[model samples]
Target: MAAAMESGELSEVCYPQDNTSCRAPKQPPGQAMVIYFLLSSISLITTALNLFVIFTISYFRQLHTPTNLLLLSLSVSDLLVGVFLMPVEIIYIEVCWLLGDVACTLYYVADYIITSASVANMVLISVDRYMAICKPLSYLYYITNKTVHVVVSLSWLCSMAYRLLLLHDHLRKPGRSNSCIGECVVVISKMAGIVDLVFTFVLPILVILVLYVNVFVAAMTQVRRMHSHVDAIQSLRMVKKRELKAARTLGIVVAVFLICFCPYYSPTVAGKETLVDAATAAFEIWLTHFNSCLNPIIYALFYPWFRKCIKLIVTLQIFKPGSRDAKII
Candidate 1:
């Protein structure tokens, strides 16, 4: 475990004893073991919940709305990561990517595809909400069923194209490339790195923020205009809650990208060798897994219906106890 952490597979922080100058908490083996246990649980729980969300939504026709469609897309992305990415991470923790190059490529591409698609979905959702709140008059036309399908399809297509470029340039080569034998296999090209950040992290985040900021501002303005909505106060408050929750979700996602991916890769992309060293590497992977792990918690907290559904599913009242599927509304 210490060896894995030291290899930058976890985060960039060294064990407290290794770097005396480090101000980080000294993780006792016992405490570290607990963290591992909790994180492992989180990975499994988040993944299962994400899959359930996707399955449940698909399992019910009444829940098929455009907004829910975007949510489904996000859930699918998380589901892929939880099933495909997290398990590999667990393996990497136990052993380096002993998988062959082809297998590694598949896993790497799967992670990239899902993560990139997640970013795109967030941006798409922000735009959807922005139009719904800011331009309600045309939202029905602007965000039609056909449009939703196109947008969602385009999101996946673009992410796939972006990843293929990375795969072609990076993963094709092994030891000579920026990546070690396995892992993300990020190539050692500054331009490629910059492009990746721009497309995957920077641009998506900027778009999400701009659209959601407009949405939030529009919501506030609309709220103020409801000066005499005395009978509608409860409904208006509910609207505000949903809008605020959406904004918070977007913010948390962008924050996760920055904290997890940007710092971890930026220094390496910039040829800062030590940043990819023991201390930072350990922190990066830990935070990266955390990004996938926290989405369900955020959804369960902010989404009332999701919370209720989770409760029902857990209690075995929503589906047969030993069944492979759920029946959530």
Candidate 2:
């Protein structure tokens, strides 16, 4: 029995001689297969959906609005989450990290950058919608394509910089948290975790909440104003209706973003240590990745252009000449 236990331990350890080595967590055959299928499905779905959005926005000239540009940035981040991060996570589920410590650090860095960009995109969307609904006349002047490009570029650059700062210790000394050979774990200090929670979750969410509330109020005011602007009442009503619909759609997106992200950060909110590992963090990690799959579905439900583009894409009609000028909207 003692020999059998020793053999099992040796199999799990990346380096048998090292006392301070990570042990790979094992799953039963049945559970492993189920998890493999579930995770792969999510990864594939996220990739495909986000890919569709990327192609649609990039190919169609008419879809190049400030709002769709923000969506394009978001879809790119979501695509990275699926194409790069999710597959590594799925592989990590079954075995020890055969990759070196540098790889481990890079993996975490990529994860942090992608997820941070996703959160930033959501905040941008909220701000865009607020501008469109609350200050329609000034929105065109203030929220032009050039400004949107700058905002999206800054969002990504900031996320990369912020995450680099946040994970500086791990990047500087990879495997600092690893006590075993096969383990890939990073323990964030309480102060750092709180800062992460604030920037990634709390602050962005508060911004979204505040902007959305104002958007709703403005939309309501537009609906209730029956006597103002007698000459342009009909045109004003049409514009307000369009803005209201957009606000509602974007509101749903923000709500889903919060739902998917909140639980992932609950431990921090509860003042618990933040530990990243295959075993403890898998559920939270996948829950957040699942949001990428949901975003395109939300677009399909709310945006007519997305549905039209999807049909063209599936039918391979997007391959034809002049498809860039296709009147999708």
Candidate 3:
């Protein structure tokens, strides 16, 4: 990986180069192109659905809250990645990169900035949920809407700052339209990977783990106090159920990110720091696209109000203005 990187093969660890605009190997013909088109269609449809849901939720004044607002931001970022970026990437992978260097620089910065922001938003949301579930009394003090705004704004700013290191060269400028460049290298610099691991992955997971642990402890304490009057087993069961619900949702989100992203970081996981081939790059692109699609299902099932909206859209005739059954909570 290092040698290929030294040869100016792949871009840096942040992968600042636009894959769609880079000169990748000619894709083998047949089943590959067919699969790529299908995947592209699925990505586009999912992005559209996410945009629709996000806009609908935002349009309703009453549904606005910190948690949902964070989700709105994530959906917007993911949708942009899916709608504007991934289609070109899918085509590039199935054929050849046709977009020029200048276009690539624009797309690269735009894509990673948004991707980085999505990670930041998730970390903030996890921290918010942790406070809400565990430190109920302190939650309001720690997690006001103003706090959310500050954290989210800072997250984007921080991500953009990380991205700026890549833009300090000819790689980021609007150059001659058709300048044929060599293959972009794999962005290595274990240092950047480590920082990403800690801030984007480790800290948020720790917050989630600690928050859930505290909630369970608090619930058990309450259950013990009620044991003489009520069935202790029943109280324990109820507490356990809610704990599992929150844990599963947050765990799934974190786990998906780790699985999709971790292998690219080190030897212990995948035995290399670079993508194996064009196939791996294609897979990585689609896996990231799939990640964006998952939040809708997560939101609809995990949040009561979002579930209400989905139920309204599915069960009742939503087109009818007088259908009270379609009302959202």
**lDDT tens per residue, model 1, 54-145:** 86566555556677788888888877777776666654553334455566566666667777898888788778778877886698687876
Better of 2 and 3 by lDDT: 2
Better of 1 and 3 by lDDT: 1
Scored against the true structure, residue 296 in model 2 reaches a CA lDDT of: 91
Higher-ranked by lDDT: 1 or 2 = 2
Q: Which candidate ranks first by lDDT, i.e. highest?
A: 2
lDDT of 2 by residue, 1-329 (tens): 99999998787776777786666667999999999999999899999889989988998999999999999999999899889988999999988898988999899889989999999999999999998988877998899999999999999999999999999999999999887777788888888999999999999989999999999988887777845765668877877787788779878987998899887788888898789877788888888888888999999999988999888888999789998899986
lDDT (Cα atoms) of all candidates against the true structure: 0.65, 0.89, 0.61
Q: Sort all candidates by lDDT, best to worst.
A: 2, 1, 3
Off by over 4 Å in 3: 1-29, 166-186, 219-248, 267-280, 314-329
Worst 10-residue lDDT window for candidate 2 reads 223-232
Candidate 3 local distance difference test against the native: 0.61
Query: What lDDT score is found at residue 6 in candidate 2?
Result: 93
